[model samples]
Target: MKRILWITLCLAVMSSCSCRQEPEQVALDFLQSFFASDYKQARVYAAPEIMGILDKSQSIFDSLTPEEHQEVKDYLSAINITVEAPEKIKGDTVRLPYRVEFSRLKEPGESFITLRREGRNWKVYALE
Candidate 1:
């Protein structure tokens, strides 16, 4: 009985730890898609609330000069992404925090973003 109880306790702890998604991996996937100029793929990781913001920002997106657009696209592609915060697991969901950096017309720029898990997938939460 004692051995069985100890084994069960150990298994529970290990299972919980192993079930977690690595925040770095999610952050990299998001950054890579964004860098490749694949907004659609990146959108897959965006939370529903983020999609709404993107919708409202469409006009801002359309007003960009071709060079500016390409520059932004290309710069985002080249940078390395890092997760500033590990995901906080909550009843099958996780929230991750990240920071991205890139050079813009010879000037360095940075932004903070959040990602949230939806079902079995992850999505960007918002721009900070």
Candidate 2:
């Protein structure tokens, strides 16, 4: 019984520790959540600076007209983003390449997303 309990505890800890998503997945998740207008969920994946920008933008977003808001939503929704594998470009920093497709446009856009390690987790540093 003691050995069984110890094994169960070890398994639980390992499972919990391994549950954190990789930086690339987190970036993709953030983009999807942001485009879906799930700001609360999206913020979880943002760095402090990004969160600050989001917080400051809240008032501006709130003041938009319904039609303007709809237009903005339409534009965001039209974007389909694909996150690529992350490469460590510098110390504790990783760069993730992504492809963005706009439904209203023909050509796709490419960009790199920068992430920094914060403790054991990674956070979005910038979208370059």
Shift of residue 108 alpha carbon in model 1, Å: 8.2
> Cα deviation of 33 in candidate 2 (Å)?
2.1
Checking candidate 1 for backbone clashes, the offending pairs are 35-77, 45-123, 45-124, 46-124
Candidate 1 similarity to native, TM-score: 0.54
lDDT of 2 at 99: 84
Give one digit per residue, the lDDT tens place, for model 1 in 1-128.
99999999999999987766555566667667755666567676667777766555544556789998887676666675666655345553444555555553465445666666666555677666
Candidate lDDT scores, in order, read 0.64, 0.80
Model 2: weakest 10-residue lDDT segment is: 85-94
Name the best candidate (by lDDT).
2
State residue 100's C-alpha deviation in candidate 1, in Å: 2.5
List the candidate 1 regions with Cα displacement exceeding 4 Å: 1-23, 35-37, 56-59, 84-88, 103-112
Predicted candidate 2 versus true structure: per-residue lDDT over 1-128, tens digit per residue: 99999999999999989977788888898778876666788788889878876676666677899998888887788788999875444677788888889877778888887788888778887877
